[model samples]
Target: MGRGYLTKEMKILVTGGAGFIGSSFVRCFMEKRQNPVVTLDSLTYAGNMANLEAVLGLPRHTFVKGDICDPSAVDFAMKGVGAVVHFAAETHVDRSIDDSGIFLRTNVVGTGVLLDAARRHNVKKFVHVSTDEVYGAVLEGYSTEGGHLHPNSPYSASKAASDLLALSYHATYGLPVVVTRCSNNFGPYQFPEKLIPLFISNALEDKPLPVYGDGLYVRDWIYVDDHSRAVDRVLWDGRAGEVYNIGGTKDKANLEITDFILNKLGKPASLKKHVQDRPGHDRRYAMDSSKIEKELGWRAECNFEEALAQTIEWYRSNQGWWRTIKSGEYRNYYEKFFAGRLAGSSAGSVN
Candidate 1:
């Protein structure tokens, strides 16, 4: 790991820090380094403040309610911030399919806003947190840092645009920008809309667990803690104008994941329902993370099975947390995305 130059103030601005992965990174930053942390979040439907409750009210942590695409908001959040770790964006693919405009505005334009602010502020380091989906579906092996991006959906294409934009800042204006793309991240505090949490939550309630298409869609899984740690390492030690892949190398099919969750919950496998696949659903995704492992010495310390059980336990114990989320706009999402798809299915109507 590169020994980063110590700045006078260890303040880092984290965009989208109230979201799932963002919140996890914030927690890791606080507990690991105890540095002054400023989080900028739009508090969108998926952005819940309770995710950061553990770190709330601490002097080292401050939350700025704002949008990343708003120049004034970003400029205000970047004040006195030595570094910017960007995580703000619309991530849900189904939502992106329904509306690509938001993805473009938030992921690409918002990234440009952060880059311009970081450059104007002369921030020491800028790490852009991205996803492996930007690589699209990889049939076999893995996608390295140099792999060509072939994003298939609005969600991934927008993220790819942001990744390129962040790097361009390094090339054109000499911003010390580093990009880290990781595989699917799962752990506590993840919004229930995602795969693991959604399945776990639905299985708990006897709701139909909708598996898209054949349910064989493959995705590489990484525990959220390892991703957060790797992002920290990248922000501090990674070279400018470089991209790193952070992956746990744990790949599983959608059907396999659903079965694992249902079995773990002692639920019937009959709960699994095959729904119409979304448009442009990638066939498979895998990631190669040798760069971060070799350079930053980061690896997954959490066992997949153990961590998954812990995740299920989290949703079980925190019923109120997910229940509240599901009771509101999330229900509308289910109706909008899955309700119509499951119209003729044998499984009864879903919430």
Candidate 2:
């Protein structure tokens, strides 16, 4: 077995650690290992400091507020780091469609900045966290790591470009970059903008659950913790310059998930409002995870319905956490984006 990098005692950096998935990784790593972790995040609309409340005060955990595109910030956070798990980027497809400049600058340019810093620091490993959306819609079968990338959205396009750039660093400069693209992630502390949490919160409030098009779009759902564990495997034992696909193996349609959330919350089917679909919406996304499972002996452990039930419970118990988010800028975006479609369905705005 090839030990790609990092001893048990070395320090690691987790970019965007204050966000949903990154925070999960930080908490998971801090609890299970002795290594110190340095977190860097700029606290965007989606990035919340409260997400890291579990491990903020831990002795080995350090938080830095900075952007990845800033070379100075990247350098400061790169010091004494043996590995980097980069999760920082603009991830929302709707927002990317609204404007793609930020995605390109942050996802592509920022990744370049981080890769250069890692090379200069001689970091033992660079784990480039990515999404399966880079493969676009897998209309049939599953997309393997070696499959061709056919990104359909501005967000996925930026990620595809960044993935190539990360691999280029490994090929050109021997940066030990290993990219892992995972399916849709859902769990506690996720922003309400995503499908699972969005519908869960909306169901809780009796707000109309906006269903895009026919709501039959399919996506492979992986619990955020499971995805975090896969990244951990890749970070430690994954061979350099390789791409691994992580999937939950639980594929569900949008309306099927909506029905589950409505039933779970005791809400009626009346709240589901069919809305015009967004442009370039992929019909389905599926990925083959045999590489990660066979190579690193890692597979998603959480059952979809069970993990989703737990996720709903988390949102139910933590209303204040999500309320604060929905009451802020997200509310404005929601109203502007969905108000036209969601109007006359009991509420005029998300608030």
Top candidate by TM-score: 2
Q: Model 1 segments beyond 4 Å from truth? A: 1-8, 329-351
lDDT of 2: 0.89
What does the lDDT read for residue 147 in candidate 1?
95
- The model with the greatest lDDT is 2
lDDT per residue (tens digit) for residues 1-351 in model 1: 233453535788888887999999999888888568998887788787778888887888877777888888788778888888899899999999998999999999999999999989998889999999999989988999999999999999999999999999999999999999989999998888899999999999999999999999988888899899999888878898999998888888999889889988999999999999988899989988888889888887788878888998899899888997988844454345433444342222111
Clashes of each: 0, 0
Error of 1 at 181 (Å): 0.5
Error of 1 at 184 (Å): 0.5
What's the CA RMSD of model 2 in angstroms? 8.3
lDDT of 2 by residue, 1-351 (tens): 236658987889899887899999999988888898999886678888678878876778887767899898888788899999999999899999999999999999999999999999999899999999999998899999999999999999999999999999999998899999999999999988988899999999989999999999999999999999999999889999999999999999999999999988899999999999999999999999999999999989998899998999999999988998988854464335343543342211111
Reference-based TM-score, model 1? 0.92
